[model samples]
Target: MADLAHGKPGAGAALSGGHGAASRRDFLTIAGNAIAAVGAACVAWPFIDSMNPSADVLAAGAPVDIDLSHVQPGQQIVVLWRSRPIFIVNRTPDLLKTLQDTKDISLLSDPDSDVLQQPGYAKNWNRSIQPQYLVLVGICTHLGCIPSFMPQANSVSPGWLGGYFCPCHGSRYDLSGRVYSGVPAPYNLPVPPYRFVSKTVIRIGENPPDGGDFSLDSIEQI
Candidate 1:
């Protein structure tokens, strides 16, 4: 004759079980929603960032101006374009002559510079319009490390006329940034597409108006 429905323990147990079930369902729903939101945020961030201009884009194809007046003779300056360092070395008259005379043409990998290391206008012995002003990309062809400009003729191994030295390995380049025969570098350091906007102002990334395989527009979009 016990009151089955009204028993205290039975009623309490039934209520507790129902509450626990509801709580678990709520937790699972909330957690799932949070996880989905996080995933969506991750996907959206990249798309948002891409809309803004990147450093490479801003600098890639833009003409970089440098003042030649401040650049001293026999010294060099490093500038950044599309995250790559470009070297502007003002060679002494003696250094220019030495680069032209001492290095044997037969020994070079690209003797006539047939490769596309430089713009069409820069395909010459010095690889620049003015012999004293040498503008070149600072990366080493061997492994892409920035080469230290060694102005002294003997800074590197003996019989080292003068040029840049890549400390990462023993790669050496002439003042024109042309690689030596036995070095690890497969080719010469690239002469970034550039033009002299004026006597003192030089642009690093853009090509001249005259047409070629590569153009200013290509670099500007970087």
Candidate 2:
């Protein structure tokens, strides 16, 4: 449908380096994202370039191969696909528990993923093929502002068990990208079709072997 959040990471995201060894990087140019003014405290970013098919990312919507060996647990990286930002988070074990916490479920608008915001394969509590890793089309469904990756408990506010927060309108999503109740974003963040090429490498824009041909448009919203 329409272009997704085409800008820098959302404002005020409290970031933490997964391995703390990643080299510092400058602002990356995403498909449709602008060099957003991410404020001061959110400046340290370490990114890597992935190998894409011969087809240009904007032209053929080619599959992108990301080497996640360097992504330490509790860290995340961003890539571009079809001009949209793809957020890949290497979830930590403790963060995984928050997704299943009853209290976490109680705060979600669709903890069951019943809204079709993700493909059938991802229609579950964890919302990904693997619970340890998460892939989301990093755009807020409300107004297309990229949600800041707030990965610490209560990072945004009290009892906030680490998730993406859209400062634009206060919409909050869990680690699994499930939308929270009473939020402006009616739908959860869209889960892109992806499959693990290896234990540490993921190919975005492609589905799991058994996922059939899942279309990005099939989701209810971005």
The global Cα lDDT (0 to 1) of model 1 is 0.75
Question: Per-residue alpha-carbon lDDT of model 2 for 39-88, expressed as tens digits?
Answer: 32245332222343335644558788999888889998989888899999
Question: Can you give the TM-score per candidate against the true fold?
Answer: 0.68, 0.72
* Candidate 1 clashes between residue pairs 3 or more apart in a chain or in different chains: 56-222, 57-222, 61-219, 61-220
lDDT of 1 by residue, 142-205 (tens): 8878999887867786766788788898787788887778878877777777777888888776
TM-score between model 2 and native: 0.72
Model 1 — TM-score against the truth?
0.68
**Model 1 alpha-carbon drift over 4 Å, by segment:** 1-61, 211-222
**Who wins the lDDT comparison?**
2
